[model samples]
Every structure is written in structure tokens, then in C-alpha cells.
Target: MPVREDKRGQERVWETRGSLPEPMLPLPFTVRKTRKETHDTYTLELQSESRPGGLAFAAGQFNMLYAFGVGEVPVSISGDPAAPEVLVHTVRAVGPVTRAISGVKPGDMLGVRGPFGTRWPLEDALGSDVVVVAGGIGLAPLRPALYQLFRRRRDYKRVALLYGARSPRDILYRRELGRWDKRPGVDVHVTVDHATEGWGGNEGVVTALIPKVEFDPAATVVMVCGPEIMMRFTVIEFQKRGVPSEKIYISMERNMQCGIGFCGHCQLGPYFVCKDGPVFRFGTIETFFGRREM
Candidate 1:
């Protein structure tokens, strides 16, 4: 097993041939709790006695969760990295496998395989300004990164989060966003496509809120997660603001059949999204990022 330290000097278990005998094998994890995040989204808290200390995962990594006989899907770890005792995943019941996983009872067991892919570069962004942009359900994957930044607020300068949803009701973590906005030195802005009754927030694309927050583009690191088109425009917006493409990271999702890149279902140009990244620097994939033909 290869053990390495991230920029924070925290030991992390990088999955390797020595870490496990079978990379495809799934371990049993008892579903501890489930919470309805929205009309179609559910957050599951899973526990496994097989590993008492819990799953050590960085912010932007995902797990190949197996729902018994149904099959598997890659879900990002949405919980705080500091509290790894209970693994948490926010799942949207959009497909058959996800529906099965999200419908599981508290005592049901789900097979868990990995904490794979690249992570948000929080350590490298230390002492710089940080901006997070999320759209719709895309907030799930970015949640863990926000937890770490808030936990160590003094390490960075200005911090901001700009999020968008279809409507106010579609907001994922409403309460937490309120709390985050109250924190000193942090700015949180939210918008929706449609303005429903009783909704008083900004009503537009997330990019419109970008100008509302203040940050030094030269020293800012921006992390984005959203629909492909949304991310494309986000990168363009940030670039126009003078944020370099190398400082902008985006999380992507594809047809990831094999979590370890054996199947090549998630190939993006020359990079295998499963092995190389789910989080990639915007400049690296600019050519094929928003192309449907890719």
C-alpha cells in the first residue's frame, strides 16, 4: 500500500495493488441512516464494521457503491472528511441503480468498493482566495471540500460559494448555506432558474453571482461542479475575470462502468476519468470538456 501526504501533510491511503488483493471486490456496509435532501434526492449515511476507523477519503473522491443485486454506481463522498467514522453519500434517484441504493432501509447492506479519483487541491490553495461554484445536484460532490475550508478558515483569504438550482425547493443544503453565509470572511450566494413564491434570492444563472463576490483573481482557486454546459461557461467567466485555467478545477461525470478505468467507459480524450480524475484542471480538458461527441 502506498501512503503519501497531501499538501496538508495528512497521511492518505492511495489505492494501489498492495492496498487490496481484488480491486473490483465490494465490501459490505450497513446503511446507518438516510435523509431526504429534496424531492428526488436522498443522503445515506453508511457504516461498516469491517473497517472500524472508517473510510479515509479526500474531498472530491467517490466510492463505487453496490446495491446488492442491482449493480453499482460512482457516488461522491458528501460528508466531512474530518468525521470519517460514517461514510455519507448524497444520491439522486435518477436511474435504476441509484433508485435502488437510495431506497434502501437503514439496516440494509450495500457493497462498497472505493474512494477513488483525484481530490480538490485545498492544500495548494492555502493562503489564497477560494471560490466554489455549484449547480443543481452538483453541490453534493463539492460539500466535503467546503467542510474542510470552513474547518480551517484562517488558512485562506476570501472564500465564496455561488450555487444555482432549478428553484428554491431544489436547494440541497439550505440550512447549511445560511450558516456558511454567516461565517466571517466567507460569502455565499444562491440563485435559481425560476423564482417561486416566497423565494427572495437572486434568480438567474450562477455566473451572474460571480461578480457579486470579491476575490483576487490572480491568487484565487476556483472549484466547480455542475452540468457540462454550466461548467464550460463558468470556466469562461472565471477566465474573463483573470483567473487562470490552471487554477480552475471541474468535476466531471461520464459512463463510468468500471471504477478503476479497466472498461474505459469514462475516457475523456487521453485521460481516463476514473483513474486520472473526476476532478480535473479546466485547462487540461478544455478541448473535449463540453463536447457532446466526446
Candidate 2:
């Protein structure tokens, strides 16, 4: 049995290679649904052909989506954890692999290799006020965490979501946001960097919406996912609000060539983003975060 040690030095037995499928081998997944979320983004709903049921994944974990000959890239699992029957990934068409992945229509086949990496610390956040902050396409990864929070809404106190997009047309889940905003005990605030006509909502960075959410700083647990600059400033804002670094978490992006840690492309300092994290408690990585050349 292979053992994996977490940042805290706790060791857990990972799967034995004999019982599980090879980690690097791609499993066939058919695209059952694909829809445009924005001008450059698409949400792909896939179902495994070889594996029955669905791919089980936790919030903030990602998959290595391969576009056949074009290659593969890391995309966060964006669907509800409870309904893993339809494996979902929100892809931004920024590179060759992503563009190919997003171009696939219904009935097309793609390769999927993982439900990998660290997950949002939702279990530890029970009974605490949960605040979710997202920027641009970063909203995709945090969507699952939001779904989990709402499913067990009674376990948490004062749940809130603050999201920022590049413009009014760039928001990822417009209909869902509207519905979440109406949920009792949940506060959903949205902002756009550049507002357009017919947009009457707030217009500013997401950090501006922080104050609008009421939470006890000491009892609040925050999850942030966005560009590095946006995450950096969001952490600063939360720090000023008195939230402890250990109580705040953030997701990171890197050139992850392998889902496992064998490939060092996703290394950040002593940790491997692909293995140790893509989600990390703020204090754990604060030393190198936002530092030049990191």
C-alpha cells in the first residue's frame, strides 16, 4: 500500500495500484452536454463509458482532461459533488488543449485521468460562517464547494458568495447566482470590473463586496479562487478584517503536466501543487505566495 503524507505530517494509506486503474492511463468519457458559459468558456458535462456510476470527486479537486492528440490540461471539477453521475468541467479556451476540449460537441469522446489534488476544507468549516470569493473563471472550482454548503445548510452559519467577473457578459453561472442570492441565510453579491448597459449591480473588485457580508471574523472560514493578484489582495483584505490565515484557503494554478507528483511542473517551494495542493490553507503557503519569481 502506498502512503501519502499531508503537510501536517499525517500519513494515510493511498490506493494499492493492483486494485485501482493506473493513474496515468486515460479513461474514456463521452461528452453528454456542452454549453457556452461565456465567449471564451464552455461547460462540458461528461459521463464515463468504461466506469459505471460516475467519477467521484470532492470540491476543489481537478481532473486531467485530455483532448486526444492535442494533449491534456488540468481543469477543476465544477459540478455538484452529490451528483457525480455527470462529471463536469468548466474550461476556458485559452490554449490548444483547452480549445480542443471546449470544441467537442455532444457525443464526442475525451480522456479523463483524475479526481486529483487537495479539496476545500469544508468538513472543518462546519458551524462556522463560510464566505466564498471568486474572480473571473475562478468561480468554476468554487461552485462545488457552494453546492456542498447549501446541501447541508443547517450545519453552517451565514453562508455568503462574492464573485467578480471581467464584465457583465463574462459571468459564469448567471441563472444559478440569481437563485442562490434568493436562498434564505445566504448572501450572494456579484460585481463586474467593467459594467455594461442594463447592469445595475455593483461594479468593482470582489474585495469591495466583502464588507457587505456580515460574519464573525474569528469564526469565519473563507475560500478564495482567482488569479494570483486577485487572490493576493483578497487575502490582504480578509487579514485586515481579522480573519486568521489558517482559517482562510485558496486554490492555485500551475503548469501541471501530471496528475501525480512525479512530474515537478506543479512544484511550489517544497510542496507539489498537483499532490499536496491546488487548495491550501493561506498560512501554509503565505511565505512564498505573491513573492516575485515564485
Candidate 3:
């Protein structure tokens, strides 16, 4: 297999002897641990079937996990890149593929491929004020980036997190979010579109909590992830507050087939979301991102 590093970061081409490139091939992994995040979603920790340390990925990258004879789907690594020996995936059993994958218990085997796609701009935002906004499962993809930012808290000026969910039950990591919120120099603001009987905080939308967090719009780097509509509105809110388009980044979720850009299923205008992104500058995708049929 020919190896090359292109726009998609380092490429690890997997090939059989005298055969075509098979980067999409899966490697066996055993489930190490499992914890239910909610009534329907659970976090699964997997380890390489043979080696303790098989692969390392950047904070925001993902893996295509295949259940035995079931199906496959891309799940972002929710754990810190610093501890890559254990791969953590928070899975919501919302559909057939996910249900099949999430049903496996400890010691069940699964196939894994890729530390694929672009990563969160943790390094680029090091010296600037950093703000992370997440919605629902979108937080899974940003959790590692947040871990990296918090690991080097002194390198940046200010760090804040604004998150929202449909309801209290839909929140992914309640305890973790609380712990991070209590840390020095770290601020977290959480809101929900719908609330429970005991809910006591903000109650409109995530954007409602934006003003509550402290950050300078011009000097801040904003990283957002959620539904496309939510991301679009969040970007608009930041732009209205003097944040430039370049410093604002969004993680784009697409129907990714071939993670290395061989397939055209994830095209976004002129670029492929799988290879060119999953993470992109807001200004880069601003044109066709929100169009109804683009």
C-alpha cells in the first residue's frame, strides 16, 4: 500500500499482499467496559484484540465500528487523545445499526477502522479565548477537544462551554459536565429546549446562554457542533457579537462512506466532508451549508 499524507492528515493505507488499497478494512477489538449514558445511549470502551495500544487519533477524529454481520457507523472518540489505549464511544441506540452495535456487552468483539477526518483546532486556539458549544450527541465529538484544552488550561486566556439538550434526560454526561464547570478558570453554561420538573437553569436555547459566558468575540475561537440548523444559528449569533468567520469552526456530519474521500457520498459543494473535513472553518462552509437542497 502506498502511504501519503494529504489534506486529511496522515493516511494509513491498509492493503493485502499484491492487492488494492483496503484502508477501510476493520481490525478486531474487544469491549472492555460499558456504561449507560442515558436510557437509550451507552458509552462503550474498546481495546485492541491483540495489542494493548493499536492506534492513536487526534481528539476529534472518529472510527468506523462494525458489529459482527450487522452494520457499521462512524463514532467519534469521546475519550482523551492522551489515553488512546482505550477507545471510548458513546452510542445512542436510535437506529438499526446503532442498536446492533450498542447491544454488545463486555468481551464482545467488533471491527474498528480509522482515526479518520479532521480534528478540532485545539492547538490553533491555544493562545486565544476558547469557547465550545455543543448540543446533544454533538458533545461526544467535542469532549476530547475539551479534554485537551483543559489539560493545558494555562496556555489559553479563557475557556467556556455552552451546551444544550432537548431535555434533562437527553443530556449525555451530566456528572462530567458538572465536574468541569467547577474547575478553576473553566465556565460551563447549560440550557435545554424542554425542561423537567426539577430543572432550575436557563430554558430557552443554547444561544441564550452564549451571553452568560465570558469571552471577547474578536479574540475568541469558537468551536460548535450539533445539528446543521443549530450550528448555523450559533454561527449567526457569534457573528452578530463581532466574532469573525475564520475563527469559528464547526464539525460537519455527513453520510460518510469511504472515509478517505474515495466515495462522493459526503460532498459539500466543492469539498468532501469526510476527507476535507468533518471539522471546517465556518467561513469555508458558510456558502452552501444551510441551503435546503445543497
Quick one: best TM-score, which candidate? Answer: 2
**In candidate 1, which residue ranges exceed 4 Å CA deviation?**
1-21
For 60-106, candidate 2 gives per-residue lDDT tens digits of: 88888999898989999999989988999999999889999999999
User: TM-score per candidate, in order?
Assistant: 0.94, 0.95, 0.92
Candidate with the greatest lDDT versus the true structure: 2
Candidates ranked by TM-score:
2, 1, 3
| Runs off by more than 4 Å, candidate 3 | 1-22
Cα lDDT, model 3, residue 189? 91
Cα lDDT over the full model 2: 0.88
Candidate 1 local lDDT, 177-234, one digit each (tens):
9999898888999999899999988999999999899999999999999998899899
What is candidate 3's lDDT per residue for 26-105, written digit by digit as tens? 88889989998988889999998565765677766778889988888888889988888888998889888899888889
What is the clash count for each candidate, in the order shown? 0, 0, 0
**What C-alpha lDDT do the candidate models reach, one value each?**
0.87, 0.88, 0.83
lDDT of 1 at 101: 95
Residue 67, candidate 1: Cα error in Å is 0.9
